[model samples]
Target: MSYDSAKAAFADWGVDTETALSKLAEIPISMHCWQGDDVVGFEAKTGNSGGGIQATGNHPGRARTPDELRADLEFSYSMIPGKHRLNLHACYLDTDQNPDRDEIEYSHFAPWVDWATDQGLGLDFNPTFFAHEKADDNLTLSHPDQGIREFWIEHGKRSRDIAAQMGAALGSPVVNNIWVPDGYKDTPVDRMEPRQRLENSLDTMMATKHDKAQMLDAVESKLFGIGVEACTVGSHEFYMGYATRKGTLLCLDMGHFHPTENVADKLSSVALSVDEILLHVSRPMRWDSDHVILLDDAILQMAQELVSAGLLDRTHIGLDFFDATISRTAAWVIGTRNMQKALLRALLAPWDRLKSAENNLDYTSRLVVTEEIKDLPYATVWAEFCDRMGVPSGQSLISDLHQYQAGVSGRG
Candidate 1:
């Protein structure tokens, strides 16, 4: 049989074609993670480099025009849905330096909609801001550079217009997600200025929308590193407490913590509207490398806790990572697998047992973390069971089950 036919036959016997194809699709995926070249806003910038948008010099990486972007989307869909949840750093666009160029270059949001529709991928917009702007409580914009500041003011209008257009095209609110990288460095530099302007701009933008759009404003808080000393919305608890109070929800990026920090406890401490907590998944580590790790049991346990606490429901997960040396497709496939594994472990957890313990106040203390999922010292049984079910351990979870079935039938 041909490869496609054989693959179909295997799938007919209950193999997961999506998982298998995702593995092979990684080979041709381009490495464009943190380069910030992909976001629609970054397109307005003048110069490009191997890394991403720059101030003056030309970017070396293959510059994709609107047509090229559409083509890329087609290619990606043919292979598999390229990661829909996108995280673009705000500083990459540098609102302070080249606001006009950034806006001009990034006006390709319309084409992005065409591609997303063709591919059947949901757009989770994450415009991560690294600098601060000042807007009056009335939502009037302000900034340090008068020229660029005015440019940003206009850029906001352009962005809203693009979003409205895209929303109409998709028949859904296009401005779906927002995450602010605003916080203090050393001491509070902008103090309340950053927070005030960001909120003001968002409130104004939301008011302009003709239809209702679901907004998940991930107020991420940082510990220390880069120029960030105190993150504006550092932890889930912090975001829940602060952003929810400001009438915005939270987005929790897991990688923003030390090993010792109790992920569940920290999550619990945030007293706010349960809907305020939105989960953004990634292995916990510093900002050094976005290496995706296995979704261990700890994360599963925490997920269970969030579910019990009503903090997470219908919240989409973001596979956030950036490694230039690896194939873009491969990184996504691996990251997706890791994420899936964590989710599976969460699904398979002894929920009944966990819930019962909560009544005794002992459950929270016994909650598992991702670390436990890593050292599955007694995973031989589970692995064997998976093998017996014909689940493809490497690429196809279903193929692994099929192989197990064939082996069992042969033995019988």
Candidate 2:
């Protein structure tokens, strides 16, 4: 869909509003980018911070304290020149260093609900879980948290309930981003057990949330690491394979593809609802090359095809970068700009011509090229158009321009 059409849809849905700065805080995006259904931000959990948690690896830095997290959000708002929004981790659930008891209050995330609401940003507070639960056909459940039966079970339930309550508190929909890191290491692994538990939990929550707000079960796929041997939504086929399953959808992470896989093809193969396609956008670089790279042409082509197929409006975009040495601001800035560049190009692309090419289908030698970057109008012009129409600036088009220009000069 065209950007204009998308904004019109937002306006029609009453999602476009001039929220007070105080209200902005309530929305996760106000503090970080990628809080929208179409996008959200994640603070990659890295070990370290003097907390001795050997579960993953020696952490580079400790998770930010609640106060520190709040301060950083405020700083992010101040320093990131344009109006930006984000989705924040109420707590890093996957981190081994984080206290099991403090799972719900990771970084005192609950308190921020009020603070974020006061800031005027709607919250997309996410709680997380690993595949700790295993089931047998006899319907037996087992968890590794030892006290899982007594503590974590209730903890997980309460977490979901509180999320619903937060939705009521903020009067907005909440998304529970689930990444089941339940896999084995050439050892015992029960994949069905975790899937059942997840589905059951989602069904329970969906029944309650049907009227007031929505819950998104964003299942992130994992590779063989940390004994996380199972892949939730292993491939787009896995997602489609389990349709009618209830209360969840597939979340595609860019890095999940095979080393030499074509992302566009993966996008095409997705069997879930078009609207259910949540995205975690980042480069899947190997070795010395920084994982952060421009969106390749194939991926853009795939996205364009999806857009033409009416799937673009349903997807949410987010950053899944893991840069420890770099400042979060720099990472977020680059990440956001890359997404915009990629999306805008996809939108303005001669999609009709590309579709025709698909029939003749030759991306080999003598490929037909589209307009030069110079020919495109500044994104700010589009933003200004949205502003005139009373739609709060969707993005800082000028910032996008500069970021793009930087890439042209090899500074990006």
Candidate 3:
């Protein structure tokens, strides 16, 4: 299964493997920083990861410092094909000062910006609404108290400013995403009040405008978290409407929906209202477990939708998973590579033929071709792309990952 043969086979279906690889190389997956540290940020006074967030397992080499995490990321990025961006949380600030969330300044994260610049990587950012004392009650932006709401709002505002600076430094637009864990564990008498408060806080936080080329605002929604079982203030309906009205990107986390719901389907529906989208690609495993993503049917369908619907350019694809059970760096390499593989698979799809069959209402042809194309030499094309990008695949990839893990095993 040489790449030439695979390319020829795809050519028979009117697909260009070279073009597919070219497109895939340009699309970057924003790898999350929390994965290396098990979501235990390096904040001066880091609080428990409440708000239904928990990363299980006690991997030996969990990154305990900013340098360690960056080292691990550098290694992980080395093994992954194509250039990618890094998604950072406010709590991951590499600073000597012990500033609280609301008091954080861009200076606190200047080191990260400098490092990213040196590595020729872009950056994305998030305001840490969880793992803070104010969010102990499972509420922050939508909290009943005005002071607490204002604090979170200020934090969000500062985060956007910092993200803008990062993007400006890197000459790329940084996605400043906001995901608050404001909900009630038990049923509440009045759900509208919290949502109203949340809307107000968001409006105030996003009042200041930055250059679109520098920063893009995004709001993420969740179905339900571990404790917020009864009601989640920032539900999908809430953020979708907010993003549509506010003219911001709506982040659709794959793990934020119900088990039966196909997140791939939402891309077309949401695209009608929202101009841009941010995807938090993760494996839920029945719940929002944040398991490292695999090249499964769900991910494949998502990649297909992004390509077939012509939404790739308007979408920001980011990884959102933290599994401490395995090598943290390995997790990043595996998940990021899987995402690229899925996109490559979709790119190689004979979409023109499939769409022609569907447009003509030829269900039999569509079904048969869809099923038959599954047997195409996708792996061969993927291996070629990896080789061109100077990264290993198959057994070589496994061996490289294990070697890195063994090297870093001495970390306390």
Q: What is candidate 2's lDDT per residue for 12-64, written digit by digit as tens?
A: 42333222112222212223332111111223333221100012222222223
Model 1 whole-model lDDT (C-alpha atoms): 0.42
Evaluated at residue 145, the lDDT of candidate 2 is 36
Report residue 403 deviation for candidate 1 (angstroms). 22
lDDT of 1 by residue, 133-181 (tens): 3322112232334454444445544554554555566565443345433
TM-score-superior candidate, 2 or 3: 3
Displacement of the residue 309 alpha carbon in candidate 1, Å: 3.8
TM-score of each candidate structure, all chains considered together: 0.60, 0.62, 0.99
Q: Which predicted model would earn the best lDDT?
A: 3
Worst 10 contiguous positions by lDDT, candidate 3: 43-52
Model 1 residue 248 distance off true place after TM-score fit, in angstroms: 2.4
Query: Model 3, 329-354: lDDT tens per residue?
Result: 99999899899989999999998899
- Model 3 clashes, total count: 0
